[model samples]
Target chain A: MLKKVLIANRGEIALRINRACRELGIATVAIFSEPDRPSMWVKQADQAFCVGPGPVARSYLNIPNIISTALITGADAVHPGYGFLAENARFAEICADHGLTFIGPQPRVIAAMGDKATAKRVMKEAGVPITPGTDILENAEAAAAAAKKLGYPVLLKATAGGGGKGMREVRAPEALEAAFVTAQAEAEANFKDGRMYMEKLIERPRHIEVQILGDSFGNVVHLGERDCSVQKPSHQKLIEESPAPALSDRIRKSLHTMAVRACQAVGYVNAGTLEFLVSGNDVYFMEMNTRIQVEHPVTEMVYGIDLIKEQIRIASGESLGYAQNDLKPAGHAIECRINAENAENNFAPAAGTLTGVVFPGGPGIRVDTYVSTGTAIPPFYDSMLAKIVAFAATRDAAIARMERALRETSIEGVNTTVGVCLEILADKRFRAGSYAIDFLPQLMRAGVS
Target chain B: MRALASLEGLEGRVRALAAAFVQSGLVRLRLSRGADDAIEFRRRASSAAPRVPEAAVFSANGAPERLYDVIHADLVGIARFSRPAPAAGLALESDRELASVEALGIRTPVRSLGPGRIVSVLFDDGAPVEYGQPLFEIDRE
Candidate 1:
């Protein structure tokens, strides 16, 4: 097992990693920015070092400073929690070169999966079902030709696209050239990679994803699927549930098999997630997040597994200790992301001293947060307040428990998405588990229009 | 934590508290010293700790301007302030290295990000500074 872990993140995820490291008898070193030096996660870990000031570019995302801190603290491994340098392949390579274990996928695997177009090609080559998409197009003419082959309404997409940027929907031949040029320029501005591709845009597909884990010795397994259809149109997941409701057993099994196979084909290690867009019985590979996801708790609740610990163990050259057949989704679990944003005010970011926080506590309820009374919410980072998750024997019961938990929870002083999560729970479509990614944004539009 | 200043054993604690209070803008540190005697320190205008109201005789633009403190790294040893306390109302360039926090023959230069005037230097040259300690104060120019 790794002796020490350096958590290169802030907020609740850092706390989450610290707890796991303690349980595994691994000493933890926390790297904090200027504002984060006074944060709770700094005090929670075994030791902490100030990397830089509050700005993310100079601090959390500073690869050299992070590596220096790890070297100074004598950390054996670094666990980048979810954001920042979590998906940065160069950082992983730097860690490997500097004799530090990066507790995630291999650098090659990360680089291969980081680019959307490359990942699609890699997955397709591995026999995974992928949506018909063109490779990196050279110019607008190439994009037009690809669109003609792929049919109308093809997506002119960036190879490095994420968060809905660097993409445009071209529904006709005349719009393809302009859309291609705009997308290419946006891709350059956003990701510095002007590479463009064409993927047949799927309409109203349910955003379902499967969680998979792989060990060093070619052992791999899947932890079923999470229905992340309840999200904004911008691809921000608000609520996620495990054992994706109403999915047929046949399709679910296929998703699991395909996820494991795709991961194993690329020699993937540690924990990862394979996202797909499911329309009816067809499941098409969308992309793979080469890191532990924010919605990991829901899968953990249903599977009864510690993903962080497993990632550590796998990175330490240990087998999974459990086979594919040994793992099973026990019940149902749901997670509601509580962000510090006003749902009533177009989800504008709200920052203030959190006056009081009342977290729901009961059987099968978990609230992961780092906020308390007098905790200052810095405007320099993301507005995530907390993650409220609840588990039950049935999906309906899980939904009810989550609804009750959200109602019981209150974070005063700053506007929160708690009320919005409640509204989502009360919606007929959400309750019936028949919603898509457009659910939340459609709700907002209905309220306004 | 401010109440430690009252205890004879906690000598020079008030100066250290004042330095941190000035730099971090941590207002309202109320530490009870038992027997109805409590020490309270209040500061204002810090956007970070905005909930804490300003104390009396303080204004947005006052005659006696606030000074900035140069914080020490969280490293152990005998820290020595390497410069004389500049005269009050003395201006400094933003890139100027005001003083050095030297420990164990190694020096860490403390430079100001904002151009300011040195109001006063709190700690003397040969003071024993604890780890994660803040050092001097300068009024922004």
Candidate 2:
């Protein structure tokens, strides 16, 4: 077992990992930027280090500073609490080269799965269903030809993208060329890889993903599924639930099997998620997130597992404590990302000093936050202020509980998405779990109308 | 009155308190040692005679017109204000209220912008203020 672990990230996720490590009697070292010197994670850790300045590139993404912190603090392993260098294969390789265990998938697996095209090909070879699409196109003419072949309403995706960036939906052939050029430009700008691919856009599909955990010993199992359909273009996941309500038992079982198969096929270990776009009974693989996802809390609440702790254990060369047969989702859980964005102002970033903060608590409400009264929300990071997750025996109860928690949440200094999240939870279509990826956009448009 | 004269030496101390009040958005500075001797006076208009209020006598004494107080509201910092008296070298001193200090309204409740932790309390007593000013600094978690 590792003596100490260095959390190479910040915010709620770092706090989440720190909590797990504490329970497991593992010491933690936190690395933070200058702005985050007084952050909750820094205070919660056994030891803390000032990595660099505030910009992510200089701080959280500063791989050398992170490694040095780990080494100096005597941390035998590094746990990247999602984002930043979590999926960067180079970071993982460097950790291993320096004799520090990276508490995630192997660097080779990250490299293969981090590339969308390669991951798709690998999934297809493993008998996973993928959307009908073409490989990366060379230019606009080739993209137009591919769009014509795949029929209209195709999605232009970046080969090296995630978080909904460098992606566009072209409704017809006329829009294909322009969308292709724009998508390429965006992909190049964001990921530094201009490579673009095309996929048939599945209309009115539910975004469901399976949480899979594996060990190096080849033991792999699916924890269950989470419904992440309530998303805006800002990539804020307003709401999420477990055991996706729309899916029948047969589809659920198949999804679970597919998730396990995909993990095994890729030799995946540690914690990861396999995302799918489900339309009716047909489910198509979207992509695999090679690290812990933002919505992992809902899965944890429903499945009664400490995923971060499991990642630590797995990285310590321990086999999964339970088998596939032992897995069972206990209850319905929902998570709402409370972001510091003004909904009335097109979800623009809201930054300022928070004067007062009151979080709601009851039987089923779980608030994961890193803020307090008088905290200054810097503009350099993500806009998510907190995550309010609710759990109950049934979906309706969970929804109701989430609604109450949202209403009780109070933040005075900046505008937040609490109102938008409340509206989405109360939405008739969302309540029925009969919405799609375009649900929020349609709601926003309707509001404009 | 002699304590008030010594309080004039509290100029640098008052300015530091003022800056802290502005930065904290809410700060409370108590009249710690000289409460009995230090008279907390608000300036009032002199009736018909065009006479300055007794509070403005300090400014008229050429004892630096920059006297200020760090106001607190129920242990929360509110605002900072220079002793509001008639302007210096004014021909006619109007009988107007020099300044006003009131408790913060409960209905106009303050709130936080994000989930952050309170790092420090700048004020033990509530802050006093003029009209427009900050209250406190919340450290983001």
Candidate 3:
């Protein structure tokens, strides 16, 4: 097993990784920006180093400093928790060059899966179900032709896009050309790549993703699927639950089998997530995240597995001793992302020193966070405050437990989405477990009752 | 009574005296037990301990009292001074090389930012330094 790990990011995910390392008896070295000096993760770490200033480019993204910190501190592995350099293939290569194991997939896998168009093509070639889509379009004429074949309301997506950037849904023929130009320009400005693809937009689909883990010895297993349909208007997930409520057993089993098959096709190792858009009986491949995702807790709670520790063991060349049939995931788990943003005012990020912080506890609840009273929320990073998850015997019980957990939570001195999440829990559509990606946005638009 | 000439052999005592003088915040110190037993220590305008908040202080007549420049490490590595570390009171040019931090076989040089007299060297040679760690304090008054 790896002896030491350097956590290469900040906030809640950093703390999550630290907890895993501690439980595994591995020493941890935390790299933080100057503004995050007082963060709980840094204090909990065996050793901490300030990498740069407040800006992400100079701090968390500074490859030289991050690598140097790892080297100087005698760390044998690096865990890029969720964001920053988590999916950066070059950073993984640098870690390997420096003789430190990067706790993720190989650089080649990351690069291949990071591109949306390439991922779809690879999945299609592997016999995974994919939506009808065209490869990277060359010109506006090509896009128009592809859209005509795919039908109206086709979506224009950037090959290298995320967070709803450089994505547009064109509902009619006249909107295609302008939408393509705008999307191309936006893609260039955002990702420095103007390549675009066309897909038949799946309307009001449930965003379900299967969590899979593969070992270097070719062993792979799927934990389960998470329904992440509840999302903000910007396509950010707000709530995620395991076992995807209301999904047919056939579809769920197919998703799991396909996820493992896809990993085998790419020889992928480490933990990965394959996202799919489920519309009625048709399930279409969306994309694959090459690193451990933010919603991994939901899968972990239900499957009773420690994914971060598994990533370390796999990266250390340990073989997975268990087979697919040995695993039996039980119970239902739900997670609510509590972000420090004004949900009523377009989710404007709020930054200030947190006070009166009270996270819920007791039966069937897990709070993963790095905040406490007097923790200063800097404006340089994402506004996520905590991830409150609850596990129960059934989906309905899980939802009720999550509601109680959210109510018991209170964070002072900054705007939080606690109220919005409570309202979502109370909504009838959400209680029925039939909501889609548009559910939260429509709820917000109608002024959350 | 100890002669100033005899004090030359007591290097440790002289260092202790300097420390005491800096701690006392006195501009100068002179101790004499006899005509031949005399020793003196003098501090520049800004050489006292707890460096006056790091900002430029002004005199009553409007002239700058003292301006200091603190140099910090830009990367993390083991600091290696190519030569002897700049001692207190050593005058240096802006571009003079003080040390280099070596990591993964790459050496990143740490240089003096401006011409100034060395007020203090915070870290020792071969110390493991992290990014933004203070390395040197220069008095540019």
Candidate 4:
């Protein structure tokens, strides 16, 4: 077992990792920016250090400082919870060089999956279904040519992008050039790589993803799938649920099988997720997240597994202790991300001191948050204030439970998405489990929420 | 006993006047209350050095004449000094290298931004230090 770990991220995810480590009898050191000095996670950890100023680049993303801190604090491993340098291959390599376990996949594996186009190709070579797309286009004309061949509606995506950062949807031929230029610029600004690829857009597909865990000893198991079709207009996921309601069993099984196959093919280790776009019975691989996701709690609730613990164990060279057949997922789970944003005002980010906070609690209901009364939500980082998850024996029960939980919760001194989540829970299509990825955006456009 | 009695309630006024002296470019200030309690404040030659941030002022020579600035480490690593660790009361020149923090064999120098006298050393030689960890407390000249 690992002895000590340095949590290299802030907010609830950092606290989440700390909880897992403490449960396993491991000491944790938390790193934070200046503005996050009073964070609950910092106080909960065995030790905490201020790495830099308020800006993420100077603090949370400061690889040099983070590595030095781990070494100085005598931490045997580093757990990069979710964002910042979690998926950075070079940071992983540095950790290895300093004789500290990275608590994730090999650096080369991260490098392979970090590039979107490369990941698609890898999955395709492993016999996984992938959307037809072009490699890095040479120029605007090349993009236009690829779009024409692919079809009318095509997605121009950055080779190095995720979370819809450098993505543009082009419907017609005339709009291709401008879309390509803008996407290229965005990709350059975000990822510092201007490479562009095109894909045939799968309209209104159900965004289902399978969670998998792999040990270094070639043992990989699937934790089933999550339906993340509910998203804002910016493509940020707001709600996720397990078993992917309404998905055919055959397709679901295929996704799970393909996810394990892809992991085995790439020699992937640690916790990872394979996202797919499901239209009808057909599924196409979108990309693979090389780190633990924000919505991992949904999977954890259904599987009864602590994924962060598994990640640490795998990094420590331990066997998985259980095989594929040993896993039995139970009940249903749903998660709603409560961000500090105004849902009615185009989901604009809100920052202020939280003067009041009340989170719901009961059997099968879990609230993960780093905010409490007197917590100042800074504008420098992600706006998410809490994650409310509800688990029940069925999907409908889980939804009802989640609605009740949201109603019981109240956060003051900043605008939040609690009201919007209540509206989504009551939407008829959401209740039917037939909502598409564009459902929330269309609802907002209709001024329903 | 006479001096203590005369300085009663004058401590607050002395602090305000000293803060104004350090912030302004004025070279000197003299004030006299009656004929007996005459107070003279003089700026040192290097007092023109940029004002140190986060300096704690303490009274010396019966007036608030000394300011202690805590020099903090800018990197997380093992702190090293080229020579012996400067002892308390050792004067420091502006821009002089006080120490360096070495991480992964790369050294980042920690220098004195202005002239000052060492009030104390917070860390021992070759001690591990984190970012913003105090290393030395310097009395600004």
For model 3 chain B, the run of ten residues with the poorest summed lDDT: B49-58
Better of 1 and 4 by TM-score: 4
Candidate 3 residue pairs in clash (backbone atoms < 3 Å): none
- Name the regions of candidate 3 deviating beyond 4 angstroms: A136-142, A160-166, A174-195, B1-67, B93-95
Models 1 onward score TM values of 0.80, 0.75, 0.87, 0.87
lDDT of each residue in A118-196, candidate 1, tens digit only: 8988998888899988777988888878888899888877878887789898889998888888888888999999988
Q: Report the CAPRI category for model 1.
A: incorrect
Task: Assess each model's interface with DockQ, reporting 2 decimals per model.
Answer: 0.09, 0.02, 0.27, 0.29
Q: lDDT tens digits, residues B1-141, model 2?
A: 997877776765565644453344232223323323231222222121111122211232334333222211211112222233222222212222222223222212333333443333233223332112223333332
Which of candidates 2 and 3 is the stronger one according to TM-score? 3
Could you give the DockQ of candidate 2? 0.02
Which scores greater on TM-score, model 1 or model 2? 1
Task: State each model's CA lDDT, in order.
Answer: 0.80, 0.76, 0.88, 0.88
lDDT of 1 at B40: 51
Model 4: interface root-mean-square deviation in Å: 5.3
lDDT (10s digit) by residue, model 3, range A1-449: 89999999999999999999999999999998877887899999999998887889989999988998998899999999888999999999999998999999999999999876678789999999999888889989999999999998899999888888999999998998999999999999999999999889999999999999999999999998999999999889999999898889999999999999999999999999999999999999989999999999999998889999899889999988899998889999999999999999978899988899999998999999999888878888999999999999998899889988998998999999999999998999988899999999899999964
Instruction: Count steric clashes of candidate 1.
Output: 2
Candidate 1 whole-model C-alpha lDDT, 0 to 1: 0.80
